[model samples]
Target: MAVLSEEQSMLRDAARSWVQEKSPVTAFRKMRDSGVDVGYDADAWNEMAEMGWAGVIIPEEYGGSNFGYLSMGLILEETGRTLTASPLLASGLAAASALVLGGSDEQKSEWLPKIADGSVVATLAIDEGPHHRPEKVEARFEGGKITGRKTFVLEGMAANLLVVSAKGPDGIGLYLVRADDGGVKRQRLQLADSRGAANIELNGAAAEPLSGGFELVEKVLDRARAGVAAEMLGAATQAFETTLDYLKTRVQFGQVIGSFQALQHRAAKMFTDLELSRSAVEAALTAIDNDAPDVAELASLAKAKMGDTFHLVSNEMVQMHGGIGMTDAHDAGFYLKRARAAEAAFGNQAYHRDRYARLQGY
Candidate 1:
């Protein structure tokens, strides 16, 4: 029911066109064939930076475009359509959220401009394991030195700056640590999606404490969850569209499988699921912008629903495409792989659903 403004629509359309032209399925195939782990194209990343995609949600004073979260979501959706590989989710959204919510003036002045310009890659290191419970953080900071291990850090191997979550004397705090710090070590994790991540080992790594306390960390997590939900929605939307296109073109025994009643019904159901997921994602974005009291709950709900939607839609997309969907040669498989990875990226469906239920006092 929510309508984007004219400018917003234009921005979304422009991103879509750029992705289609520059970062198409052929590019993904090439990356996969070359055994590239991250699947990122440097030229495409620069193009995105030039188009202000990196600064969509950053404030104006920070050299960003200052568009807001909705615009960021729109761009994410377009990126999903192509399965374009980049650190947009980790650097552009997660790191930016942390900086906006908790960084000091000096921290902001030092990092935000570089991030807005895409000159630096950053990511948040919070999950110490497969289970993402920040409150259970065991990473320790003592005397301005951090020592701990963080697992499953998205884009961890590539980030220039890491906003690390640690247990301070008072409570949880965000610490800014440069990746090149002497005591820091990063081990690349070979994930199923071909996206880059790592396990970071910190042994007395020098860190600058962020300004806020646990409350600010919680707020940043909320924003990060909302941003991830938006990205999941993008993946889900792309999966549905990809399946729809395949159904229309691929012939069956006599005609296009899309014309069959059963296939049509399945497509309709997938579309419905996609729209429902979109509504939840949009609600989360609005809650974030307005600082709604239920923002956390809405974010969990959106993430949970979109996680389920992505799984169902991506699986269906593959099934509808038959054997070709399982082969790496087809674009459908790429979307499926990305969707499965993203479903578990920030939090899986059951994880967020339980969080949502707890938030609702269930």
Candidate 2:
């Protein structure tokens, strides 16, 4: 486990308090029922922005605190506990990291302040298919214009800017494409998670390329994968705790189910896996913050471990709860659905496990 500094602890506590008081699982249910196209509460996002949550990874000169990636992960972990749906991960961490790491001064000056202030939402427009495949991009950039389709863009419909990937003459490159361009069209995706995601069609839209080539995509994606692992850690922890509480109280055969040896063993395994997963997650985030050369390896480790742990815990959350877990009225279903969506987001267990092996020269 990574040791938290005084400020890091404070940030985690503040994030925890805010999520519990302002945005809980109930809030998520309400958002789903209300059919909000943005997939989050606008007022709540503004509140987070005012608290500087959106600017955690952005440099101070760019209107952010530049606290670092680990700090942002802490906030993400807290928010994940309640299953809060927001663009914080997409715009705040993923999109912001692209700018912080590779954005030209002109690009930084034009977009970073708006991102930090919550005035604009941005997200990556990569992956042309249903699965995560950055290296297989068929989109091409020529003559300062990009034409292609991007699917499953997180917070896509709400974004004002898209950090797009395409085949440049120099090789694969990142482009800053405006959503408001006439050539751009968006189709909101109604996912099982009910989050804000879209499929985009860019028809010869003007784009400004970022400095880094394919290498930069890999770097930006590492940050994204690590952040997702942090959020998964928070959700998995909560699921285990909630299930453990249910075990302690619910009676089966005239005794608390906690007395059952089989259930006790299952819970114990989950606790152990969660602890190990936390170590991997914190290590990955810390690696990014420290600019470690082995970041890709750690990222794969973190995401794969977190994916397996979350998949196990979420399945057990439903199985352990018995009947209530299967119903829409219970929050177990929410966790289960979220697990499926998040597991597939950046890379699933199979994907990351393969990546990890390849990185290790297997």
* TM-scores for every predicted model: 0.96, 0.99
Model 1, C-alpha of 1: deviation from truth (Å): 4.6
Alpha carbon lDDT at 14, candidate 1: 97
Q: Which stretches of candidate 1 lie above 4 Å from their native place?
A: 37-39
Q: Give, for candidate 2, the lowest lDDT window spanning 10 residues.
A: 36-45
Candidate 2 positional error at 65, Å:
0.6
In terms of TM-score, how similar is model 2 to the real structure? 0.99
Judging by TM-score against the true structure, name the best candidate.
Answer: 2
Model 1's number of clashes is 0
Model 1 agreement with the true structure over 1-362: per-residue lDDT tens digits: 35888988999899889989998768866765676545476677888888888888788899898787878888887787777788888888889988988888888989988998889989989889887777878899999999999998998887999999998898889999999999899998887777778999999999998878787777777777777777777777877887888889989799998999998998999889888988988988888877789988888888888888888888898899899888876777777777777877777788888888888889
